[model samples]
Target chain A: MVMRGLVCLLICLNVVGVCHDVSAGMYDEEEGAFETVSALNSDHRFWDDVRLTLSHVYAYGTSESGAIANRSSLRYEFDTTFFKRFSLRLDGRSSLYWKQDHQAGVDDTNALAQNDLRECYIQAGFDAVSFKAGKQVVVWGETDGDVINDVISPRDEREFVFTNLEDARLGQPMVSMDLYSPWGDVFVFVTLDPKVNETPAPGTRYFRGPAGIRVENEKPDTSDQESGIKWKKIFHQFDLSVMAARLRQNTGVLVYDHSDTYKKKYPSYWFYGMGARYATGSLLFTLDASLKRHYQLQTVDISGRYAGSECLMTDNALGVEYDAGGRYTLNAELTHRHIVNDQDDLAGVKQDTDGLFIQYRRLFLNDTLTCQYRFYHQFQEGHTIHNGELDYLFSDHIRVIMDYTFFRERNQRSYYWTYRNDDRISCEIRYYF
Target chain B: MKKTALICLIMVAFASAAAAGQAREIMEKVDNRNDGQTVIAHVSLTTFRYMTQNGKTRAMEQARIKRMTFVKKDEGPREKDHKSVSILREPKSEQGIGFLQYDYEEVGKETDQWMYLSALGKVKRIVAGNDNEPKTGSYFGSEFNYEDMEAYNLDDFTYTLLGPETYRDTDCWVIEAVPVLRKAKKSNYSRQILWIDKDRDMILKAVLFNRNGKKTKIIMSGNIETLDGILVPRKIVVDNVESRRRTVLLYETIVLNRPVDDEFLRVRTLTDKGYRERKLQEFKDLK
Candidate 1:
C-alpha cells in the first residue's frame, strides 16, 4: 500500500511543477537539481522522496544456566516521503539463534530461526499534526545513553535466542495520533488484538496481556480495548510527561497459584508510571515512579473448579538517574513488590531492591582516542549483582567494547536462577550514508 | 504689542545660538574632522571587562585588536577614506588583511565602498548609506561596525545643546542625534548624544540611550595627537551601559600616506603565504 501511494504521488508531481517549494534552499548552491532529476518540472503539484537502509547485528553470550548462545539478525528499512507532509515506512527483521548444551545435566535446543515485522506504518502530517497507524516502535525518553531505548513493547529483542522467553511477541497493530503545539504536545494511541491466545507466566507477560491466561471468555465481559494518552510539556529547561492507560485485561501479572485449601480465582495486574527529565548544558537528570498492583506471587492449583488455573502478582518501582557532561551517568532505584492473595498453600510476599550504577568516558587527541568505564551494583534482598564495562573508540565510527559481570552475596545462590562471574569482549564498525 | 514682538524675537535668537553652540562643541572638539590631505594610523586595542553581581565585581581579560585606517578629503563636496585592518582574534578572524575604500559621489546624496579581503582575494563593492551590512555586524569580540565610523548628518537629528562645558579640559558641545527612521538597520540605540570639542570639531565623549530611553553605552576618545598635521584621537574607550563589558583601543603608530605599493593588494599576493609573512615583517620594521 505504501509503495503504491508513493508511485501515485510521483506521477501526480510529474504532471505538475508545484513541488519546488519543498526542496527550495535544501541545497545552498543549486536550484532545480532535485526537480530536474524528478519528473515534476512541467506542472506544479506535489513532491516525493524515497530512501532505503540495510543493517546487520551479531551477539554471543554464556548463561550460568549451562547454556552458550550465538545470535544474529538482519534488518531492512524503506521510507517514502510525499508532499513533504506524508511519510510511509516499512521495516522488517530476521533472526537466528544457536545454543550449546550446558556442562550441568540439562537438555537444550540447538538453534532457532525467527522473522518479524518491526514497523509497517502509513503516516501523514500537516504542520503540527501527524497521524500514524499500524505497527511501530513507541519511544519516550530523551537521553541517548540511559533513556533512548529504555521503555515500550514490540518484541523481546533477544527472545529468539533466550529459550525461556522465546514466545514473547514483537509488534501489535495500533493507531496513534500526535498533536504539536508551540508550548508542548499530546499523543493518543489505541491498540486492538482480538485473537487472544495462551498466557505466559506472571511477571513475564506482554505490556497489555493478562498474567499467562488466555481468558478469551472472560475478556468479552471485561474491557478488551487498550488505549493510552500522554501529555508532554517543557518547563524551563526540563521536559515533563504524564501518561495514563486503560486495558481490558490485566497487564502486569503472569502465573498464579491457588492451594487446595481455598477455591478462589481472580485476575492479576495493573501498571502506572510518571516521570520527569531535565537537561542543561552538559548535565542530565531524570526521575521516574511506577506502580504495579495485584502483582504475581506464587500460584497454586485450586482443588475443585479452579484446579487447572493459576493466580497473578505485581510490584512498584521508584527510580532516579543523573548524568554529568554526557560522558558519565549514574542511576539509583528502589522497588517493592507484593503478592496479592493469601491461602493455606499460598502466602503473601514482598521483595525490595536498591541499585546504584556509574559510568565514565573520555575522548582525547581530537577525538581520535577514547576510553570508558561503567559499574553497576544492584542489591536485592540479601544479594548483589555487580556489572562493569569498558570501551574504546578507535575511529569516528568504530569501537571495541568489553564487559564484566559479577554476582556476590550470602544468598546469591538462591537469589537468581542463574548467577555467575563472566567477561565478554567485542568490536564493531558502524557507518551511515 | 510691537515691543513684545521684538522681545520674543530676541529670546528665540538666543535659544537658537545656545543650541547650535552645544551641537558645535560635540562635533568640533571630540570628533575633529575636515582637516589634512590624508592621515593614516595603526592601532592596537586591549580590553578589560568587569561585571558586578550581588555586590561583587569579577574582572577578566576580554579581547585584543589591531586596525589601520586612512582618512582623506571631506571638503570637496565629498567624504572619502582609505581604510584597512587585520583582525587578530575571534570576532573577525582573517589569516590576512582586509582593505576598505569609500568615496562620496555627491554631497548629502550618496557614497560607495569597495572592500577587499585577502582570503577571498577579490574586491566587493557596496552602496553607501547602507552601512548596516558592514558596520553593524559583529567584528572580533568587541562591538564595532562600519556605521560606527561615519560622520552622520546633523540635520537629520533634533539637537539640544546642553550648554558650554569643559570635558577632560576640552571645551565641548553636547548635542543629541535621534534617528528619523524608526527602523534603521544596525542601530541598537534609541538616542545618542555626543560631546564634541569646540576647537577641532572632534567628538570626545558620547552617551547612548536604549529603546527604553535608558543609558546603554558610554564612549570616550582620548590621547589627542597630530599626525601629518591633522589632530587625531589616539585612544578609544567604550563601556556597555547595561553590561559589565568594556573595550579600549590604543593607536600604536600614526603616519600620513607612508607609501604602500599596489602589489600588496593583488590576488597573487594573497595566495603567497611566504610573501605575506615577509610583507608583515617589513611593515613592522618600518621606521
Candidate 2:
C-alpha cells in the first residue's frame, strides 16, 4: 500500500491500468515470461509480442511547386523464443506510394506498392558464444552520421538523405558468430548474397546520368562470398575496435560499354579499418579510419562518358559529441576522403574531398518533444545541405514528425546540382499498437 | 558580559557538533544496511501529471509506463562501486534497448555508461555530461533524475539531527541534510529533510527544497518487506511539487544475493541481444 499522498498510484497501477504500454507482455522475475503473459497484463493472446505501426507521410516541394511524396506504410515486428537458448525475430514493412504531381521527374512505370522483409533471423545464445543467421543487418562504425567505416550492409539511398537512418539499410542474408572472451569480444560475419545500393531510377529527380542510356547491372562473383571480422575491447573510458573485410563495394561503379550502354559493376575491394572512442565527463570523441584497396572509380574516357579505374583511397572521420547527459546535445564531425592514386582523373570526383557536419538536439516537456537541426558542407565543391526537424509525441502510441530540408550549391559540377530544386518540407504521423 | 557571550557561543557550537556526529552515525548505519551483493529486480515505472484541489491528489488521464529488468552487482574493491545493466522489456517502440553503467565510488570520479539501440544496431558510449551546469534530465522521463538512482556518498552532505517524532505511527528521527560546497555546485536541491525509521534505519520520507529555497519534491517509501533477512522497500513514490507530476517505482519482484556473472554487466550485455536474453532468462529462473 502506498502512502496517502500516493494513493492515486495504487488505483492507477491496479484497477485503472490506463497506460497502453503496460497492456502488453511484461517480464516477471518470479513466474517467468510466458506465465506472466498468462497471469498479468491479462492478455493471453498468441500474438502478445507482436507490434504494429501505421504511418502516413507527405512531402511538398518548396522549389519545384509540386508534391514530392505521398506515401502510407505499415510496419510489423516481433520477437519470440522457441527453446531455452534460441529465439526468432521477424520485422517487415509494406508501403504504398500514390501518384504525385511531377516535380522535375516522373515515376510512370514505378510500382505503386511494395513489401519488404527487413529482418527474419534466428539466434542461439550460449555461455560465452552466440550465433545468428538469416537475413540481417550488421552495422560497423563509430561516427554518428558519417559512413566512413560502415561498409557491411548495402544502403537504399533512393530518397537521398531524407530517409530515416533506421529505414535506410537493406538487410542481406548472412551468418554471424560472436565469441565473448576475457580479453575482448570477437565477431565474424559471412554474406550468402551480396547486394548493391539502391539508387534513383532514370526518371527520378536525383538521377544524373543521360536519359535513355540503357543500364545493365553486373552480378557479383557468387563463389567469393563477402565476409568480415571485428575485434573490440574497452579499457577504462576508451573503446577500441579493429576490423577487416574482403567484400564487394555496395555502390555500383558506372562504365560506358559503347552503343549508349552503361554497365553498373560492383568490384571486389579489401577494407581495413580501426576505430576508437574516448570519453571524459560530458565529452565523447570518436575517430574512424579505413583504407580500401582496388577501389573502383569513374574516370572520363575517350568516349566522353565514364570508365572504371582501380585505385586506392582512404576515408576518415573525426567526431565529437557533447551530450551533457541532458536535454541539449551537440555533435560535430569532420570527414576527409583522399584518392592516393589519382593519376587518372576521375570524372566528377575531387582528388581530396573534406566535409564538415554538425548537429544539435534538444528535448522539452519531459522528453515529449524533440527539436534537431543538422548541417553538412563539402569544402571542395562548396555544396551544403541543411535539415531542421521537430518530433512530438501526442501520446504513448502516436507521434508526429515534421522536417524541412534545403540545399545550396556554388557550382554546377556538384552532386546536388542535379537535384538542386528538390528542397521540400515533409511531415509524418505514426500510430503504434 | 563579553566572556559569558563567547562561552555561550562555544557551548552552542559544541551541541551542534554533537548533533551532527549523532546524525552521521545514524546515516552510516542506514548506508551499511544489508542490501545484498547482487540484485535482480523487475522495475515498473509509471509517470503522470496530477493536480491538487483541496487535499486530494488526482492523476491525469494520460500516463506513461515503462518496464525493465535491472541487474546490479558490487564489483570493484570500493564498497560503493558497482556495475548495473538494464534492458527494456515493454513498450514496443523502446524494446531491445539496453544500458550498461559502471558507477565509481571515488569522489569526483565519473560513471562510464553505454547504450545500445536495436534499430541502429550499435553500442555507443555516452557521457554523464556537464555543460557549465549539471544535467537536469529526468531518468527514463520520470521525476527521478540520474542522481536519485545512484549510490550516495556520505561525504557529499552534512546531516543534522532534529530530535525524534512519530511519523506514520513509527518512531523516527528527523534529519536535515545540506550539501557541502563541492556537491552544492552540482546539486539541484538546496536542502533535504528526511524522516528516518528509528528501528530499520531507513529513510521513510524526504522533502526537498529547490536551489531557490522553494519546496520542490516529496519522496515517500512504503510497502516494506523483509526478504532474505534484509528489509527492502518495494515501492517508492516521488511527487514533484513544482510540476505537479508524480512517478511511482514499483519493484514487482526482487531476488537478492544471487550469483551474477561479471560479464552479464559488461558492454556485451547491451549489444549482444541473444546473450543478454539468455542471461535474463536465467535471472528470471533464479528463486
Candidate 3:
C-alpha cells in the first residue's frame, strides 16, 4: 500500500521560493567563501564528508479528487575506507509525515511511509580482484525504465510503473566479487537472502485482488539459494556484457485453494541476458535481451480459480539516445516480449506483446530548469501512458521536481486498465545537507 | 639571373618553415613542463552572472559554490594521455559523485569516461558529451568547458607567432592557434590567442573565439606557486563574454608528486566508494 508510484505533480513554487530565501541566508558571499573553506580543508571532522537529505512530497488525485499522499523523508549516507583495502558504506532512510490527509480506504500507515537501507556495502580490493558484501543494488541493463537484464534486485511495484525504477528498487543482501582483467571484467554474485517484489497490498489503489481475500506468502529459505555471473568488455567504440543467473522470480505467482485465500509463491528459474551499447557522434544505441526458463505465469478462470503456467519468456529491447548538444535530448526504445510456451486457452493476458517508449527533454535558464515529456504505448493491448515533468534546480543543494501522468487503456484485459483512472499531479522538494 | 632568383625563393621558404617550427617548439616546451606526475588537490569553484557597468565588470550578488577533489596522473610520456578523477565534496545534493576519464592521444581514439551516480547507486559509462551546445557545455556549471579543462593537443591546431609583448610586467610571447579541419568540427572555438610566459614556459592568459569568430571567453591564470619543484597555478578565473558569467577556480590545498596507486585510476575508483575514500585520505592528509 504505497503511493510512491503515482508521483503527482503540483506547482508549489511559492513554498520553494521561501526555501530559496532561507538557503540564501545560509549561503554567504563569494568573496570570502573559498577563503573560509581553505582553513576547514586542513582539518578532518566527523561530519566532514557525511551527507544527509530531507525531502517532502505532496500528491493530489485528479480522478478521485482526493489527497493521494503527503509524506516527508530523511536520508543518511556515508562511506569511508581504512587499512588501504577495507571500506564500508552505511546508507539508510526513514519516511514519515506531518499534517497529512489520507485518501478514503487507504491504509495511511502502510501507504504513506516507505523507508529502506538503500545501499550498505563493505568492499576489499586486491590488485585485480575485489569482494563486496552487504545490502546493495546492482544494475545490469541497457534499456531505460524497462527491465530486461537489470533484475538482480526486487522492485517495489505497489504503484505499478508510475514510480521511477531508481526509486522503486530494493537493495538485498549479497556478496559480490569482481575480477578486472586486460581482456574483460568478470563479476559474480550470490544472494544471501532472496526476496520478492512489493506488490499492491490491501487498502491501496490498483489492488485488483478479490474482495477481502486472505493473502499468504511462500518465501524461499536458505536452501533456495541463487547466484549470477557477468562478463563485460569495452571495445574501441562500444561495450558489451553477457550474464546468466539462477534467480528466484521477482513477481509472486498467485495460487488459489478454492478457499477464501490466495498463496503467493516465487519460483526459481534460470535467466540469461546480454546487453551492448554503441556511441558515434552525438547518437548512442543500446540493446538488451533476456531469456528466462521455466518462468511462472498465472491466469484466473471465470469461476475464480487460478492456474499456474510455466513458460519460456524472452524479452528484447533496442534504444537510441540523441543529444542535440545539452539544449535538447531525445530517447526512444522498442521492446518485444514473448511467452513461447504459453497456453492457447489462456484468458485475460496475451502471449506476446510489443511496446514503444519515447522521451524528450529540454533545458532552460542556464540549465537550472529542465522540462521532459515521456510516453509509452503497448501496441498489442492498446494501452498508453504520458508523463510530463519539470525539474528545477534552485541551488546546488535544493531541487524541486513536479510531474503529471496520464494513463489510457483500450483493452479491459490489459493490466493498465486497472490504473486508467490513476492520472494525477504531484510536487516534491529535496534539500541536501 | 634565374639561379639567383631561385636561391632567394629557397631562403624565404627555409625561413618561414623555421619560424613555424619555433612556435611549435615553444608550445611543446610548455606541454612538456614538469608540473607533476601525480596531483591531488582540493578545488573550489565560485560562479556568478555579472553585468558590465562603466567599462568594469561587476559580479552579481548571487553566486554558487562547488567544491571537489581533483586527482590526475599522467599515463606515460605521450601528450594529452592521462587518467583523471574528480569527486564532489560539497553541494550535499551531489556529494560523493565521481567522474572518471581516460584521455588518449592516439588518432581516432575517443576518450573513455564514466560517472558514479550516487542517487542511482551505480556506475554508468558515459559518451563523448556536450559537443555542440555552448550554454550547457561546461564543467559543473562553471565557465570552464571540457575543452578548456583538457590538455591542448599540439597537432590539433596550427600555431603562428604573434610576436612578444610585456603583459603584467612580464615578457610574454603572443601566439595564435587555428584549429585544423578535423578538430574544428568537434571544437567550439575557431581560434585561440594565448599569452605565454616564455621564460617559465607557462600559460598566463588565453582569449578564445567561437566558430563565428566572436570572442567568447577570456581565461586568466595567476597565483603561481612552486610546489615540489613544479610551477602550479593556485588561482584561475574564466570570464564568459557572451553569457556575462564568470567562474573562479581556486586550489585550496594541493600536493604534487604524491604516490598514487595505479589501481586508483581504474573504473573501480568510481564504483568503490570506500576504496576511493581510503586511497584519497592518505593524500588528503598532507597539507
Predicted structure with the largest TM-score when compared to the true one: 2
* Model 3 regions lying over 4 Å from their true place: A1-42, A98-115, A301-304, B1-21, B52-57, B76-79, B129-136, B259-261
- TM-scores for all predictions: 0.42, 0.92, 0.88
Worst 10 residues of 2 chain B by lDDT: B52-61
lDDT of 2 by residue, B1-287 (tens): 99999999999999999999999999998888888898898787778887656655555657777778789998667558989988876655566788888888887677888888877888888786662455677887789987787777888899999999898778999999998988787777888999999999999889999989999998888767788898878777787879888777777778888889887888878876657666766666433
Per-residue alpha-carbon lDDT of candidate 3 for residues A1-433, written as tens digits (9 for 90 to 100): 2234322321243234223221121122322222222343456566755787777777777876777657777788877666788877778888774334342236434334556887888888777888999988888887884778988889988766656776888888899999988788899999969777888767666577766777688868876577999999878668899999999888877788557888887888899999998876567889999999988788776776775667788999999988675458799999998888745646555788899999999887666788999999989999999999999977776788998988889989777787888888988887766
Across B105-149, the per-residue lDDT of candidate 3 in tens digits comes to: 876776777778867766666666544333235687788877788
Better of 1 and 2 by TM-score: 2
lDDT score for residue A285 of model 1: 55
Please give the C-alpha DockQ score of model 3.
0.35
Worst 10 residues of 3 chain A by lDDT: A20-29
RMSD from true fold, candidate 2:
6.6
TM-score, structure 3 vs. true: 0.88
Cα shift from native, residue B34, model 2 (Å): 0.8
- Candidate lDDT (C-alpha), each: 0.44, 0.79, 0.77
- Which of candidates 1 and 3 is the stronger one according to TM-score? 3
In the range B1-287, model 1's lDDT, one tens digit per residue, is: 99999999999999887776656545534333644443434444434356656644344432333333232333343333332424231112232344343333233343333344432333332323222312233233353434455545544455667667877767876677776562233355678887777777777788888766899777777657676567766666666657546555554555554445444433223322333334443444321
